[model samples]
Target: MKRPIILLMGTMIFGILLSVLISVLFYGKNEVSNSIDAGTKKIVQKEDKDPYEKVDKTSPTISVYNSSTNKIEEMDIETFLYGVLSAEMSSDFSEEALKAQAVAARTYIIYKKENNMTKGHKGADICTDSNHCQAYFSYNELKKNKGEDWIKESYPKIKKAVDDTKGHILTYDEKAILPLYFSTSSGKTENCEEVFSSQYPYLKSVSSPYEEQSPRYYTETKISKYKFVNALNKSYSNISLSVDNLINQINVLERTNAGSVKTIQIGDKKLSGRNIRTLFGLNSSNFDIGFENDTVVFKVKGYGHGVGMSQWGAEGMAQKNYKYYDILCHYYTGIEIKDIY
Candidate 1:
């Protein structure tokens, strides 16, 4: 009877141990499976994610008035900027300068479009005429003008400039600004009110010391005393400008903070410097007059309106290792570089 009782207790103990071992094996398998499943899920989640999910990759379309062809053409913003960058700045400029130009051009277009400033273009958002709006040259036109070798070397650079900047634009107070830019400045940018009728906070006067290397920075235009007197007389009916007394007749009345001529006393009339620049086809309004016998030598500094970002100045900043955004911000005061889809 004692042997049977011991055998029964041993059988029960062995059964209990077997049940515990089976339960432990099943639990261990489940944990390993769960670990593998979690890792797989993590891999799948990472694979499904987009690297540029937050980035704005949209390139909008716009209408540009082709002044050469006298027609309105539709193009994507990037393609349009390719033409603008090619026509606006030298292809030999540094990559950062080119990128800065791309953003400025983009901002100008958006500002015009948002403000409904298309009446000048006959219902177009902008025009290819450099006189009225930004200049744009198509690929074929560029190939014709710049030669195939230049196209091969420079087209890619221009396209990269546009692509790298994508949809960047200059803004103030969360709104797009005019983003006016020019070939060079007279050691400083002009105040908006001095050049245009309106004043802009971002268009205030700022130092631009890098434009000295520009070919148009200091230029001399020699006009015959007879031509000078006749030109002023044609505009001012009440003035008398004798060739011998031309120096006395023409005097710079006032200069802006940027060293550009603000007002000039020509004969009996007080004219804005911009008026004289237009009349004489001068390179810029920052000019000093000197007499060389019968010639009226107009020594001018800089080019364009001298209102905003100087292209040569931008290049100068690029040479100093400044990034594109830095160049833009330096020229356009109190402005933010924003991305528009």
Candidate 2:
């Protein structure tokens, strides 16, 4: 009876040891799995944080490629606008016109930056080339053009224009529009489809009768027949034409909705109006060609592509007591002015 009781006690001890071993193995595996899960969650949380979370979205600093210096300069948005405004428009323009320019320029840079349309410029959001991006004027340049006293007087006005329209941008369908402004118009703005391949509703043709007030409204460029033929040959090497053939064949075939030339037949070689303008260094495509005493005379009626906002037209409206918002609305059809901030 004692032996049987001892054997029973040993069996009970063995069963207790086996239960403890199983519990230890299962608990150890579960703890490791829970730790791994906790670590993975921590990694995910860290990865989700945005680097620019603390940045000010309203007024971000931009990198400008100074083409003259071949250097990248960092500048605040408003400060950059001061340089652009000084270079783009004359200080003699009215306060309202300056204000309109400020808003348009601000919108333009914002659009360019957002779209990464800097044309592969390294480490720069924009360039100082007016043909590529927008023109910029340094303080010294402004002083040289307008004198120190005038800069002191006009700088504040330009700053006021930028300040008054701070964070303001033109939007179409709640997105920022590509606000393009030119020196002057040919009494009307061209549709986007006429100049560019894309058609934009807000960039439609609009009458701008006030641009005649601009000093650059009308310009005349003259090229001799020999020079004209030489330029054409340089552009189109295969073209074999005499001055007489050019004179007889070179005629405006079609005009855009805004009265700018669409196409011109130059000795059986059809060239775009823009191409002719570039080849001859003409001011704008809105031109009339004529032969005057062995010279090819081009009478240009505008100072730019005849699209988007006309800067001189804005000045004219401002001179007539129109507000900045009114000028913007007139130029950019069916658009809303909103504060980005």
Candidate 3:
């Protein structure tokens, strides 16, 4: 009876061993998987931390002179930025590009305010006239121009871009620089002295390889020789112009490093390229003139002043997956992006 008892104990021990093996085979994998998942979760949480979490969400208030209404409207800087971004950049552009514009626009306004550059805007910090300051449009104007569907679909995207980089501005040497930006470039940006006559180290000429998508990248404006001469004579009242000898008389006196016309001579009057561009309604200072029959063809390259950031080039970089900071750094050399609030 004792021998039988021993054999029974041994049989029970074997069954227990078999049960342990099965449990190990099935349950061990799930334990290891759970351990790996927990490790991955920790890494993802750390990586997804917001860098600007401590920044104040409350934007500073600014007085904006609405040129159309001719009234001073006091609103938060972000609210002002909405109108500026809507008028300055197209909503169809990449989010990164829009973010870049927001930062530049903010920097520009801050620079103006800090330096007391409010001489032109009466008591306001800035004006909405695109010719004077930056272009701007109210929400109602946007709805009128872009329609209700666009406001519902695309307007929120612009607001999001502005919010993502709130209170952020570009700076050089810890001071806000005059962050000038333009619509397009003539293959490269111009130096500060070349265009604005004031030299800023950060606003150096840089190669802009991505503005081919701009509609104004290459534009040809055809004007009658008679009209062209009259326009030039209107600006320089003493200059004599003959339509027959217009091409021969017109000579590019100087060109900037980026190939923009620095100084151009038409007849006896020497005019800066910026003056000629404004006087003749040319899209950019970088232009070539030629006669096609009785018409004078002005082949303009790019648009705007061709200084600081190139908006179309920023969009091109954004298309290649560049971030907003990357676009700003590429255009405005040696600048730091920091919170102004």
Candidate 4:
């Protein structure tokens, strides 16, 4: 009995000692890891010397401006390109989305001096809806698969798009491209004209709301077999002239939520709502409210904001074995990618 008690006590003591040793080992490792991380942070915090001034006629740095904040900020060419590509690739997207954005950083330094965005603010949203300088692409995507081929293929396309729009301002003839936030309340795509409504909580409400005789228009988009096919063929805008009466057909190329057929009384003629609204702005007292409803509609065609870069379309073309330049040229017109610097 004495011998058995001694053995049991010895086993208990050994177990306790093992637990203590394990705890000490874990704590020592955690402390070492913390020290290394702290040291790394210190190195990052140290100010990087600006060697840009002493160098030769160097690359152009992108300037960011905030119209609302009235502040100007600057970023490196690569960082600026990354920001542009990231935002365009996915609105508030991650940096890992594209492989193309990564490779563009290297070539942009040599080919172009600076990039610019007209309506885009200086901070996070620095690129625009269109392919001007800030286009939608990802270098990170290309880096994952196909390796260096992304540079050989994706570089010239983006560089061309950027080069073409470089030094060019967005304008229709002499009319400046006034930046207007797509009141998503009206739905996506330029097809919908945005009218201010108290319904939108995010936007500033219009003071002294005007009443209009025109039909209260609401944008509604739906994807069925027909809409998808129409969008793919770019024939969504085509108006039908002939209808086979066998099907009891409405021959019009109809819009989604335009209410009744639009009518305009101009002098002696009654024009359509679409044409009249284009000529004269919406006037109150012209039409009375019939019914009311609210909803968010996706009227988007193609994809990716229908702006500068179309990632879906690019992927589509890539699947068809289209070169990256062919994809870029299809979306952006009159752009040449050249090595300037």
Candidate 5:
């Protein structure tokens, strides 16, 4: 009986050991699985921590003030550029000239945005008024202006020019430049100091012999001698006008380096040529006065302020096979083309 009892005790001990071994194996497998799951969860949490890790850096949007509607509109930069290009430059220009205009327009706005110079406009980065900011023509307006077929043909070309030179801007010394462009020039572009209060090294005088292609290169407007004197007196209240004083006394007192009249002596008062141009509705400051019969003839040369890039000159250069960058560099003077994106 004692031997049978001892054998029974040994069998019970073996059963207990087998049960403990099974529990240990099961626990070890479950621990390995839990560790793998925890590691995967940690990796996922890490990835989710940075929300902007895969955000797109390009295609930024801007806020514009629609002067016509008197409302603020938000749109993508590229879309805004389409309107600007359409209104600012004619689609008939060469692709390279259009591209150069695109870069210049982009640089101008970016510079304005960077400087926070919105001219007191509320809740907007820029405006649609071309005189104030940059000119903008909506797709519908462009269709109306050019017709459906012309829009279909020309819009793609304009889009190509804009897209091919995407994010390109002019930079002087690694900073954005305030690129001022105009319709045409006399034989040369004027220095910044000559036109505006501030002087810019890049805005120095440069010969633009190619601008003769512009329709406004040579224009003449005739006004009666009495009307001319009255208009001058209206602008400059100090000026005393009469037929005898106006005959030989009215002459250009000073001229800019580019040959645009800088100052004019009318009767006893001396006025800026720009003032005279504005008073008489002249095309440009470059003008010569003559008395023909009963009319005072004013022969004007070029158009606009003639302070920077000449659009007609740009088109002429493009016709001569100059690339967009080449045209920009020639006009801007010691500048670099940079991709902001």
Candidate 6:
């Protein structure tokens, strides 16, 4: 009887141990699997020599790559990230919450290219808003979620990623955007399956935000020749640079009203959107049609989506001597900042 009891007990112990081992193995696999999705998993599970881990041998070049008197000047990843942070933290963000906006922006930009896209460099092309590919706009209006630590850590992780990409971001000359990816309120970036996905929490009352909504006006002013080159690379005749042609371009943009319509009405002539942007300098998302009083009555606030990486906020932090990592930490949360370069 004693021998039989001992054998049964031993069997039970072995079974329990086997179960625990299986559970541990599964837990680790899940941890890694949870990091990315089916597609992203493939990207993460590649050989070290994977050029995608560093820089791709293939990358698209700028349109004006050949027709250039000056070599395309590359910007530092730090500078780009700094710009993103500074813009996102603008104080004019009265319509939306600032912190969440910054996080979403960082999330979008940082996670857009995982494993190694962007040659390990992260950034987006020149856009008034950070909505080219990475991270769409967001508004955390449903309920104020609590994840301060998570929120705080986003910035640093992003900074570390940018640091890793510094060598690449500083060298790639074309419109080297930080191939970041993002999602609308869809729980995923692929499709906006629901109405309240938070991508456009700004449009609370409206569904399918295809409606045209923005103020429009015109103005006339002369801008420096170099200014036009930096702002928009309109094919300028290597032969001649006419300021009037610049004005005409603005008129065309305003008439189309595709992205923006900033025109200057000088006497009887109307300037173009590009021209007015160049002249009046439409730096932020919204522009001033005209000043109302002591206050600039222009529709504006929180640079970018009001969703991520506030440039003004960053500048404010930088003024306080906040290290880049510290600044990133303040915005993002729950992510380890690994220098994979």
Q: Candidate 1 — number of clashing residue pairs? A: 1
For residues 137-180, write the lDDT of model 2, one tens digit per residue.
88788889789898888899988998778888889988889987
Query: In model 1, how large is the Cα lDDT of residue 119?
Result: 78
Q: Tell me how far the alpha carbon of residue 11 in candidate 6 is from the true structure, in angstroms, after superposition.
A: 1.5
What do the candidate models score in CA lDDT, each in turn?
0.84, 0.81, 0.84, 0.33, 0.80, 0.32
Clashes of 3: 0
Q: Which is better, 1 or 2, measured by TM-score?
A: 1
lDDT of 1 by residue, 1-341 (tens): 99999999999999999999998876644412211121102101111111222257778889988999999989998999999999999999999899999989999999999999997798989999998998889999999999999999989999999888888888999999999888988778888898899999898777776788899989999999899889888888787667776777888989998888889988778998889899999999999889899998989999988888899988987776666876777778788877777
The backbone clash count of each candidate, in order, is 1, 0, 0, 26, 0, 47
Looking at model 3, the pairs that clash are none
TM-score ranking of the models: 1, 5, 3, 2, 4, 6
Please list the residue runs of candidate 4 whose C-alpha ends up more than 4 Å from where it truly belongs after superposition: 1-58, 67-70, 91-309
TM-score of 1: 0.82
Which scores higher on lDDT, 2 or 6?
A: 2
lDDT of 6: 0.32
lDDT of 4 by residue, 104-206 (tens): 3333333222232243443432433233434433455445643576567655554444333332222222322222221111211221232321221121211
Model 4 clash tally, residue pairs: 26
Which ranges of candidate 2 are over 4 A from the true structure? 1-58
Q: What would the per-residue lDDT of candidate 6 be over residues 217-258, giving only the tens digit for each residue?
A: 222233444554343334332323333434333223232211
Error of 2 at 333 (Å): 1.5
| TM-scores for every candidate against the unseen true structure | 0.82, 0.79, 0.81, 0.30, 0.82, 0.27
